[model samples]
Target chain A: MRRHTFTRFAEALPAAVLAACSGPQSPLDAGSDEAAGIAILSWVMFAAAGLILVAVLALAAAAARAPAEQPRWATREGWVVAAGLVFPIVMLSALLAWGLSITGGGGGASSPPAAFRIAVAGEQWWWRVTYLGPDGSALFSTANELRLPIGQRVEVDLTSADVIHSFWVPGLAGKLDMIPGHVNTLPLVAGRAGTWRGQCAEYCGGAHALMAFTVTALPAPDFERWMAAQAAPAAEPDNAEGRRGRALFLASGCGACHAVRGTPASGTIGPDLTHVGGRPTIGAGLLPTQRGTLAAWIVDPGHLKPEVRMPPFPVFRGEDLRALAAWLESLR
Target chain B: MRRTLVILGLLVALGAVGALLFAWSGLYNVAASVPHWPPTRWLIEFGLENSVETHARGIEVPPLDDPALVHAGLGHYEGACQPCHGAPGQPPNPLVRRMLPEPPYLPGQELRWSPAQLFWIVRHGLKYTGMPAWVAEHRDDEIWAMVAALLRLPELDDAGYRRLLASGARMPAGESARLLAAVGPAGEALVACARCHGLTGAGGGAGAFPALAGQSREYLMASLKAYALGTRASGFMQPVAGALDDEQMGRLADHYAAMPTPPVRPAPNAATERGRAIAERGLPERGIPACVTCHGGNALARNRLFPRLDGQHAFYLAQQLRLFAVGTRGGTAFAELMQATTHGLDEAEIRAVAAYYAARGRPR
Candidate 1:
């Protein structure tokens, strides 16, 4: 019975370890050139440490089993100097130099200059991402989700609206602190077109654990199309229910804190909803983007994400809430 | 000692049983015509006085010297108070005197209690007494106005009382209904409203009642329903609205909605410019939305549910905003949106916004 349990545990352990080491948010499962270098460095250090451990164990076993009278060379201080001092110094210096070369101070070690700039401000519990124009003026802003073209080096200017927050996407580059009143640039290059997860690495106040986002590396043409669509006004509702929802949204003063392009909702207190429907998730990636989730969020955001700033709207009822969610979903 | 203790215990038990039997034998008279025993009356009065003093202790009094406030209070007093608590030289109705613990006459009664005690008694009426609490508990501003007028009651004779109400464009309750009879059945229902809000629905000039004229029928109807349902907090409007049936409420809403907006005199104070800026641009950094977006500042078609604020009284607007800021001004479902938008505004900003709207003319 004990052997059977042990066998089962052994079988499950590797699978779990492998699974944990290869997610969209795992540094070992690299998707960018910079992250690949980090993965390689991690593996090299692991292998070197394992080898040293084995050598030490073997030497200790041999010493313990052997006679009390040891050889002159084994007992000499010169052996200690060669084994501990010289070996460690050379090995550490090599590792440090290699590491510095791979992860250049700004990362994107071998990539060309960044093609475009993206500014991401860490809010209380959400990421406010803005796509900047050539002259560095803000083109448009979105929240929670970020997208850039694959194979292009993108310079991301990270800052905070309130407190210090660390922006980290394990599959991309490395963690960087987003400090208030100061901007830190993180250069990232995505080698493959795929989605990656990013999280707040530092402890912010309430709802900090839920402050997460996503990075989608799109193809060049698709990325351009998305940018243009996001820049334009929201698409007009195609149905009567959608129109009613739009009227309610404006009349209920949702426009007071949120801006929908091409509408009277020019307020910038909350996230922009121009392309919110197209996003994969909402509420700082806390929920999947769907009609049901959107309606749930609108009616009771604090219920799902504690200490969230958005107030619940008890006013939206069955049909009204459904229509509003459906209309927002249709904005894509 | 044991024998003596037994006797005393038996005697106490016998006394308790005798008292219970005397009380339960339908012997105590609860009729209003029957006066209470002197000791019982003293005990009840003692409890009432202590309770009021304890509760009214922490209530901070606002400055009540404003004549406009006194004027507004007089208007309400004539409608809701005068019949029960008579003005100077005019005795209360003879029939009111027949009730047990009759309501007091008000000419010189203000001298007995401090303003805070008066406010407390008016806000939360004495239990088992004929006095009733204010219709809306959240409307402290209106209650303070009553206190302001109550403070002046001792100095006003019958002529002074009538003249003060007249200067505020208010009349007695019966006179209001008789004169508004030409407005049809809806006007008849608005007698109480007309006492404070004028005949054409123009508010008291210094901002007593809200201007209801030219408001959308939908908005007015919703507000009336909210007041009756106790969802909207207003001591003045709730009782008046609660007394009406749905049909009467509809008629009244239609009547008020159709009344032409009276010409407004622009009262541009120093804050008007700042108020105009906030109404138009808003302090976006603080997440305060421009007031005009929801309250109407453009020619664009807006939802009728949003009330017209173009010619609303500055005092009324400022009071409502203060209520919203403190999270007490309950209104229609849309009011929650204003709670969030106005949560961060300072008092100065609120007054400025009100002044801007008050000085604004009806949009063309």
Candidate 2:
């Protein structure tokens, strides 16, 4: 039963991966390595469940065979009750110990050192991620998706924007709730290389079903390079289109809902877009990053994403929109 | 034993009968038109208010760093919020005024909450007051930052509010206003966005402020237009965009898109780089689209309403996309594209994308 569903899920993934390769680099190869441990853990759990099912069936059969001659208060009935109480306790205690060990319990070992700390605040529908600088200073901040290297240990400081939002990545770790005001901590490590899937485990609201994210694992050096890039100061464009695009960004009022690095558009009602060109996806990887799609979204944002905070730019299309897209793309 | 059982049965039957009679006789008025009796209204209000307070009690609040959280929140306040909650420089929208429990003027009556409480109100939203929960999860930082910013409302005047918006404020002299303008001979055009985003692009807004130092550029640019066009769908963005033009928008997007992402990050135990690769490239096998196609790829000729994402906040990005995918994304005119793009993705994709984008750096 497990094999059937597992194979089906696995097969569909590769197909989808092949279809998404429109960029210079991808994490396909790296994904397998990262997901190995997580996959193993999941499979192991499934196997354990299967074993339990078999055992229960066997026990049921035995009970049926022996209970035919029992009276209401027979000595055999007392034995069954005692077995139920003692056996479950013993088994559960062992399982608990095993589970704790896997999660890095006891004095035998300490948690992996935290390479970095991210404070994630769960809002009604979105996620707020704040990066901590080496010195514990507040550094980079943004929303949705949390990125990390394959081997590093990260301390995720989780909180909620409103109601309860549970953060969970089926392949990496268990679920943790982000409650309003209070911060919860979750320790996560990507075992190998690969992208792991996750979602809001708690019911937050209308957008709860759509709240999702990916954890990408990469080589150490590559991750380091990424960190350096994330730390660099804002760069100004050196071309006319870029200049026009910059102006358009502010005047068009993109600043009201978003924040860009080093600009008058310092509003924080939405995502921080200090490096739009650097990313490969938008709407958290929901839409293909394309000029037409971007243009369509801009011309009428409400049509693309309903009930969102940022408004539409009615005065975009053709050259103007093209110029804007060009300038934004050239940023990287 | 029989008599006791009979009595118990009779009590149960009576309870059931009472409930059925209540239902059949229309004992409770469900009409929104008439206000509930004072006792019922108070009971409900108390239940909702207290429940939220009790449940939210355990939240751990990090100390706020910047004093400008509200200062930055001003732009959003003027642009979207003022329409619903009357502010120093503006009055409530006539349409919003008609809402059943018309949103109050935050500066006057709604300022009683702590920043966290305000954040909860904004992020989680009220039950029947037409208040909507935050469009996305993990966006509490932005909302809380706004709440922190709102703390100053009582002391602000129309002019003060406008000033906070950078209204009439020009970038440092000699700074180039546009990317092309900022280059060569643009020594003067190099205005430091750090004044707001800070030296490292880590935003200067207090606790709830967004970090612009390290965000995805494409999402940034797109977000800007979404606000301007009222597509991203924020109640606060329209008026903000009302005063600005396209050129300024593009320039801002460019500057931020070019900034380096922050160096300090959350403890790196998270498997974000794998997600990063997806953001930098695409998960072809999963049918996940590349971020650059619209945000930074060659497919587009230039920037439009989209803001730059070089140093944006990760929490904010993840939250917005979730909003879009679930039909809750709000801002300006171009939010529709986000909806279309997000419609097919499952929760896994959104999380992956958020993590990938969160760990990204300035694009090359």
Candidate 3:
């Protein structure tokens, strides 16, 4: 197959390229625009790197074959000036502008349609996600990970209580800060349906590095179903284990720090346990949200975050712990 | 060349002999009475502190939020900590003072610790310190609640403390009271603690629970967080504070801080007065840090991992000296740096130290 005129084919293209060119492309061939961009950028970067390497090899060959000369700092400076200063500044500015064209920030302008508002408050080592979406019909609240439809635009409001913090997702866009005293907004447009990793970029304190979450972009219907489930009021525990856990949680002052939309555990000092069972990890994604790990965290809280505000539950051992853990897990 | 070599050899031999003689002669007092020489003291302190700080830099900590974790911590505190540390308005047993480093007034946490620093100290108990590492094998959530409890403890009064302490103090207090507040608690934790910590912020102090009123907000706030997260190592508070949130902590801190700083009695002797001057004023001319720099940075923020010296138990401060020397009593990351300032002091100094701090005129 013939390559495009723009293709500086120093060598023949691959068999995959030959196959790809054999038929008219399908409508879904390239996936989303972001995926397309990623593919193109990867090729461009590889080509540029190959060309540079070849040029360097040629120069090295010439030098080896030719006579040696006294080293001059002037030549070094000129080369560095062109490659480091002139070339980088030009290339980076163009790339930055191009990136903005893809995801608007710093003069690039586009706002997420204010469909729903979620206020994310950063705590000692976890995230408290509160949905201010329309009451029962459109509301959604979850922790650690944030979910949205693949094609829809979402705005995240960020802020912290103790120190400076940042929000970042490697696959989507750049990092942004969640400073104290004021709120900041960032728009996210995920182009494909996949679970993208999100992490807290700023070092707020002792456990800064472990902070992580996911940006799950789902098909529209799945996303809607998730939202609806989230908005629905939390389940009232009736099963033996769950009833016991809820009672234990409240009796132990869990109500003092947390809130369950439908329950009497109405303290707002911590996360809303109204739907804790749905979360994959506890303690802001620090530990896996399994019964045993949950039990351990419930009992101590010290090993995980030293000097942490949460105290240990020494009194509950054996079945008391099991019943309480079972109850919290039932809050789904 | 021979002369040079001879001189070098003699110097080495003389140094070795000098060291041997010193060791054999019992010239250097290992007793707490005599302080280590300044240079040696600095080396030891630097090594210990630098090691801990450097090591702690890598551990990952997540943001704190766990309702269940906090709940469990509360129950743990009621059973384990109230006996020694006391609750809001509840004072610790006077006998605890007889043990080195008397248990601090639990509710007045502002003078206790910084959140992160507390975690580190808790994980690694100090040497020669009475403060024990947490009993729970994996103590993440419990620590956070203890922090929450510490924040809340300061505001609770005797009635409140008892209510929180009891395993069955529910709001409605009867069958068919199925408000979310009356959610099922199958085990010991199925009970409410607000009865003791108080619906309002007032906690116990005059009774079994130490009165949290007028204690350091900073200490109370940070210590609560530390205790919950197990950063502030304790038999109980770690679990209790672990169960709360920033709002509860704020509420607790505010409630207790608003209470009056307990009135101060005059020191029993002039020595205590002198100690007070040392703590408040410091030996600035002698390159000593003001005890208040860390302690009194902010009465509310005293929990920056520094226990409040003002109105603390004198005997407690003295025992803390031995712990601080060994690197145990839970402290902030910079706690070891605190040692250099103390290495120069004798046991007499340690006793005078607490007297001065404990004698601070009153909580403000």
How does each model score on TM-score?
0.84, 0.42, 0.44
The full ranking of all candidates by DockQ, starting with the best, is 1, 2, 3
Error in Å for residue B69 of model 2: 37
- Clashing residue pairs in candidate 1 (N, C-alpha, C atoms within 3 angstroms): none
In order of listing, the candidates' clash counts read 0, 257, 159
Name the regions of candidate 2 deviating beyond 4 angstroms. A1-45, A58-75, A103-109, B1-364
Residue-wise C-alpha lDDT for candidate 2, range B175-208, written one tens digit per residue: 4244336533422222333334432345533312
lDDT of the candidates, in the order given: 0.83, 0.60, 0.59
Query: Superposing all C-alpha atoms, what RMSD in Å does each candidate have to the true structure?
Result: 4.9, 20.7, 19.7
Score candidate 1 by lDDT: 0.83
Better of 1 and 3 by lDDT: 1
Q: Give the per-residue Cα lDDT of candidate 2 at B273.
A: 61
How much does candidate 1 score in TM-score?
0.84
**What is the C-alpha lDDT profile of model 3 across A94-128, one tens digit per residue?**
87787666554322445446556567767666776
Residues B1-364, candidate 3, lDDT per residue (tens digit)?
9999999999999999999999999977766545568897778667756765775675555454533233344556666666777667656777765554355667656635544545555556555535566665344444655655555666667777555555222334343233223323311221223333332223332122223445557656766676666654555455556666777666656655565555756666676876866665555333244565445534225233344455654444565565554445454433444544555566676777766765655332
Interface RMSD of 2: 12.6
| Poorest 10 consecutive residues by lDDT, candidate 3 chain B | B183-192
